[model samples]
Target: MKKPPIWFWQIALLVMIFIIWHIATSPDLIPPIFFDNEYRAAFFFGEPAKIFNAIWVWFMSGEIYPHLWVTLQETLLAFAIGTLLGLAVGLWLGLTPLASAILDPYIKAMNAMPRVILAPIFMVWFGLGIWSKVALGVTLVFFIVFFNVYQGVKEVSPVVLNNARMLGANASQLLRYVYLPSATSWVFSSLHTSVGMAFVGAVVGEYLGSAKGVGYLIHQAEGAFDINTVFAGILVLTVFALLLDFVVTFAENKLLKWRPQQAETETT
Candidate 1:
């Protein structure tokens, strides 16, 4: 028979993971290796069966929808706002050396600062609302896109610039046709990380202070020492992030079609 497909191995790995998790946390199985009481292992790591049940119950009851919605709202809002701001600033500074020189220290300082601590300050200003989370996420996302776009603009080939200029291309035309197309790839490259950062910011803000969102659910579970519920929340968030990443990948494929495909080398 032909070798199993890649997805077969992928699913096999997932099944193997669950199998190992089940054995490790099962009261009837390997608990003796780690603990005297069978229940102790289940208590600490949590049984995979219980974790899945918690997730199932959550969806079946429709209780997770509102929280998931709130989280998604925060994430999308932050991602859009941050990307626009980063793109504008990155292009502005990349084009103007004098302005870039003046703001270099300040920009570096802000990027170097620990952004998490600003969450409390944002909560103070935005009053424990989604804005605070959005602000926190913007701080995280802004730098990644800003740096990437800035580099992309700076790295535009001088020969390319001379050709464009020699062709009598105006400044605006250069920006539209040359700079943007070059930076487009860099912006797309940073998007996945920026989106993940935005999600993290939303969750962390909710974890710190919020009435809803999956992070709040995890917080409540932690408070109750409900290990299975906590793990379920984590698994849900992981799935949610993967879904967002899939969206990014789909968009990347559509938008980056203009980019030439790199050929793979053959092996003997």
Candidate 2:
């Protein structure tokens, strides 16, 4: 038996989505159901065309790039800082049992709390500028990578560690040759997820308080009752999120080439 190429399935899925969206949103395809003088069920269910039109307008007008760049900047900065901190902390804690024991309760308490609610506090401390958004994003991204790397290092084979130690491997050699290699997959796995979380944190921070970023644009559109534009802004954020995820995936593939490749999983 033979299977279709993976890209063929991807393209087919995209085409099917386009077809359904076009059919559902075409003005001539369905009649509007009036809910009230001001509300129409069709408007709610059939806004795909409107959303696409708004996106077209944005692209043609070239007004979206600046906002997109602002959001990207915040997301990237936060991702870098958060991932670095997570890697460092995860390694340190994984290597030092005493330090891990001392910080366990405090770390758990902080991670357990609703971090987003701290946005206002962050804004008060860091202002409504990009720093606040980056701070929020860093908070979101940090714990994800931290937990994964911590677990990854912990999961290193005891037999392997014993053999290395018996062979006279020092602390630095064990970390370099054993812990990092063991944790590489876990780090990349968390990184892919952290990318999205970082973006979400940044955008939500912008929503709460910001003069710029795509989230602010979306917030403005909603206040003006421009549903189409709001949807367009959402679409822009989703596209960029996918782009960032793709970047992480590429890095993971490059870094974890020693890992066994798995069959592609079905995506909903």
Encode model 2's per-residue lDDT on 156-254: one tens digit a residue. 999999999999999999999889878767878778789888899999999998999999999998888777788789888888888888888888888
Q: What TM-score number comes out for model 2?
A: 0.86
Report the lDDT of model 1 for residue 18. Answer: 95
Please give, for residues 1-268, the per-residue lDDT of candidate 1 as tens digits. 8999999999999999999989988887754686888889889988899999999999999999999999999999989999889988999999999999999999999999999899999999998778888888888988999999999999999999999999999999999889988987899989899999999999999999888999999999999999999999999999999999999999998999887767657768
lDDT of 1: 0.92
Off by over 4 Å in 2: 1-29, 37-39, 42-46, 263-268
Clash list (residue pairs), candidate 1: none
Worst 10 residues of 1 by lDDT: 258-267
Clash pairs detected, candidate 2: none
Q: Model 1 Cα RMSD, Å?
A: 2.4
Best by TM-score: 1
Choose the strongest candidate by lDDT. Answer: 1
